[model samples]
Target: MTFHVELDEPRCVASGQCAVVAPDVFDQRDDDGVAVILDESPADDLLDDVREAVAICPAAALRLVEG
Candidate 1:
């Protein structure tokens, strides 16, 4: 199964936790402080880390949509 991740910008405060947890998949646009997804489908090994990021995100800005 593949999951797509997206950021709700309004809810995002650009804390960079998601990027820290999954740099291969997430990044912060330095100027704007917005979460940028490098890949829609991250590696299987990264799934756990991404899920941890989702759980740890204080602003609830990240979401994992299974498709």
Candidate 2:
């Protein structure tokens, strides 16, 4: 199964947890620190880290969508 990541920018609080948990998949904006999706469709091996990032997002702005 493959998963795609989505970010709700308005809901993000710039906690930086997602980037910390999955640097290859998520990052923060240099200015406002908003979450950024580096790889929308992450590799299967990164599922765990992506899942962890989605779960720990302080603002609940991250989601995984099966495609």
Candidate 3:
């Protein structure tokens, strides 16, 4: 199964937790530190880290959809 990452930019709080947990899949904007999706469809090996990022997001801005 492949997972797609969705980020609600309006809901982001710029906490930078997502980047800390999943650098390969998530990053922060240089100007505002908003969460940015580096990889919309991450590889299976990075799923665990992505899951952690979604769970740890304080603003609940990150979502994972299986397709």
Candidate 4:
């Protein structure tokens, strides 16, 4: 299965939790500290971290869609 990450900036609170959970897949913008997707479709090895980041997002801004 392949997974894709999505972010809703308007709902984001710039918490940086996603970045902390998966540094390689996510980062915060220097200007707003909002989460930025570094890798929308990450490798299988990174799926766990991506799911964790999505689950822990306080604003529910992150989602993992499997295809």
Prediction 4 TM-score vs. true: 0.97
Score every model by TM-score: 0.87, 0.96, 0.96, 0.97
Q: What is candidate 1's lDDT per residue for 1-67, written digit by digit as tens?
A: 7888888888988888998998898899979888888887887778988898888888999998876
Model 3 lDDT tens row, 1-53: 79999999999999999999999999999999999999999999999999999
Tens digits of per-residue lDDT for model 2 on 28-48?
Answer: 999999999999999999999
lDDT, model 3, position 56 = 96
Name the runs in model 2 displaced over 4 angstroms. none
- Candidate 4: which pairs clash? none
lDDT of each: 0.86, 0.96, 0.96, 0.95
Model 4 scores a C-alpha lDDT of 0.95
Candidates' RMSD to native: 1.2, 0.7, 0.6, 0.5
Off by over 4 Å in 1: none
